[model samples]
Target: MTTAPIRLGTRRSALAMAQSSQVARALERVSGRSVELVQIVSEGDASRASLSQLGGTGVFATRLRDALRADECDLLVHSLKDLPTADAPGLLLAATPERADARDVVLTRDGTALADLAPGATVGTGSPRRIAQVRGENPGVEVRDLRGNVDSRMRRVRDGELDAIVLAAAGLSRLGAEIDLVAEPRDLAAWPAAAGQGSLAVETRADADAELLETLRALDDPRTRFAVIVERAILAGVEAGCHAPVGVHAVIDDDELRVRAAVYGAQPGDEVVVDRAEPLAQEYIRPQGSGKGADAASRVAHERASGIGALVAGLLLDRGAAELISPSTAS
Candidate 1:
């Protein structure tokens, strides 16, 4: 008897394909299941409008999810950052595989760091969080809106059209972009990754086949899931979208988990940073008769992380950070 190949849906972009290919290969290796890539072109990819104008949430993920719902695909792969916070009815975020480096790196023309760039140097980025952070670092640098694939952005810098550009380190790595002048953000005030940055979301329908769910669970990493859970929880607690001018990062250090968040208002001067670290002492549960023992740990860890995230978000909001991102509160 032959096993049917699992259909994995992904966006049409190169970076999307690269990431999906990796997951497909891994799934095949671990489960001995053949995998097929189903290319999906998202509205975000087809639209020329700015991401902010598109509501910045679900533009890239919605179509793929629709395909999942229609049973056009068995599984969907998405950049966890692009996956919105609201729970999609009849769908499950089945797994979050091991995360990659979540830092943002500055790519320069002459291999010079951001600090070394001449005053008024044009830096290209499309993210409000990145723009605010870059401007905060160097007030004189001229930050400009940028869009397109990794190659096009890099080409602009190479051709001297842009002095520098800041992009997610994981995307650069996945696309194999040869980055020479790289600068990592060392401070939350200056830089923090978006919630779920550098992570992959494996989503499946609520009624997905049992064997497929088991295969996906095998790829899920508890620590990565916990970190993204806390980060996303902070976004949800703040009632902010994934594309909001907010940066969040979570890390697991041995028995301690630290969650850091930064909120940048509509203006450059309006910003706040909050960080919280706590002991990872969530109660562990091992379900009887289930072959999976780690599932319980994953759920407990996410719960603890969510609580910590809510605490951190509340701290910032109390300090008036909410006004920065809220349209009603904006001056």
Candidate 2:
């Protein structure tokens, strides 16, 4: 009987295809088998009219995931940030490769720093997190809702559709559309990134397509993997990090992990309390599951990350960040 080839379901966005290529190359290296990318038109792409009008976070991820469950594709690739915190039935986040720069970059025409962007200058971004932070920094600046791949977004600034736009450095770098940075790219303290920015997730069926799963794991890098786990855990506590304009930045330091995230309320734009946590930095994270059981490293990281997140949240609340909470989920 002929064998079915490994089909990798991915979104049609430039960055999504770009990230999927890495997975394809790795699978080839390990399995010595050809890997094919299946472009899945995700809901996010179809509903490009505006993200704010869409129901919520899952639009970008659900469709590709559906393809995997339907056996139309053997696996899928996703931006860790775009994935919903709520787990999918019969699906697994099998592997997360090394992370990228989990920070936001402020791009502008004059090449001025974020703080230097001319007052009242309009900044383009669809992210609540970036918009809140940007407005907090410059109350007079305008925050516009922008959606599209790196090229489309960048062209806005080039063609003067916008004066400046804020975007994830990782997205730009992966799409090979790097541009002049109006502000330095840094972590949570400097500029908190949308929860899962700069990270990638590889999803497979619950049964773990034996050969495919093993081959993909070879691409997993310990440092970035652990960092994202902690980042995602912190995100979980916040309920789909996107809802609150939440952003997280994490790193491995001295065998100890220092994590930080922000929670902003629905104010016109204000400083949300940014919090920090330190989970022990074990070199790598491997789940110890016995036939559907939870992972050992994930359990440890999840509990520790949330506890620290709560502490950080409390700390920030006390520091005049109580005003950032939203009255109801802003659509």
Candidate 3:
């Protein structure tokens, strides 16, 4: 008997298709099953309103998740950064593949860096975090609201309509887009990226079949998963949405996990930043569910990582992150 192809749900954007295609190929290799892409229109993709106006978080993932819940697809792929910190009913994040570059890049018509851009130069981006970071770096430049796919946004800069635009380097790499503009990658230390940036999330129904679960779990990279979990935990701890002026980046180096987070107030000068690191437990470093002790180890590791995240968030809140990121103050 021939097996049915796995239906992978995804958005219709070029980047989404590219990343989803990549995941499809990987799943086919691991499961020895054919995979097909099922494009789904999300509200975020359909609407022209600013992300903030549409509500900062979950705009992109909601519809695809709905399709999954409705049995329209067997799995869904999402840009993890766009996914809300909150869990959806009946869905589980089955996998987090290896991460890509989690830094923001400045695309300019000329070779001008963001800091070197002439005062009053216009930089386009719709992200509150980018807006605040751009302003903090060079308050003289005029930051303009920008929305659209990567191609359209880059076109504005190429056509001289905007001096530059901030975009995720991971998106560019995934799309493999070719352009005639200069790209400058920002330092993560100075400009932390959104939580879970540069990662791809493979989601599926919580009660998926054992074989399907195992296949999806094969794609999980523990290091990437742990880091993103810690980063996102901080986002959740602070009660901020994905589109808020909050930047959190976590990385696992050797046996240590380090995270840097920032919450920017509406004003350029108003911000709360925190940097913290912790040693990773042995079980988290190893593949998940390798032995009888695996379950207990995974649980403990998860709690410890979450605890560290809460600790950092507490530090920020204690230092006025709550006031800095409050909706009334942040926007």
Runs in model 3 deviating more than 4 A are 289-295, 328-331
lDDT of each: 0.82, 0.71, 0.89
By TM-score, highest first, what's the ranking?
A: 3, 1, 2
**Candidate 2 segments whose C-alpha is farther than 4 A from its true place:** 1-4, 178-187, 240-243, 268-274, 277-323, 327-331
lDDT of 2 by residue, 62-152 (tens): 8888788898888898888877776799998887888887778778777766676777788898877777788777777888889877878
What's the true lDDT of residue 294 in model 2? 38
lDDT of 3 by residue, 211-273 (tens): 788888889888888888888889888888888888999888888888899999878889999
> Which number leads on TM-score?
3
Residue pair clashes in candidate 2: 265-324, 265-325
Which of the numbered candidates is closest to the native, going by highest lDDT?
A: 3
Candidate 3 residue 119 Cα shift, in angstroms, is: 1.8
Candidate 1 accuracy as TM-score? 0.92
Report the alpha-carbon TM-score of model 3 versus the true structure: 0.96
Q: 2 or 3: which has the higher lDDT?
A: 3
Residue-by-residue lDDT tens digits, candidate 1, 1-331: 3389999999999999999999999999978979999998899999867777666777899899999999999999999998888899999998888999898888875667676678989999887778877887777789888888898888898888999988888887888866655455445334788899999999999998788888788788777888888898898888888878889998877778877788886565678888788887534211212355555565566677778889998988998877778552121
Every model's TM-score: 0.92, 0.86, 0.96
Residue runs of model 1 more than 4 Å from their true location after superposition: 180-190, 282-297, 328-331
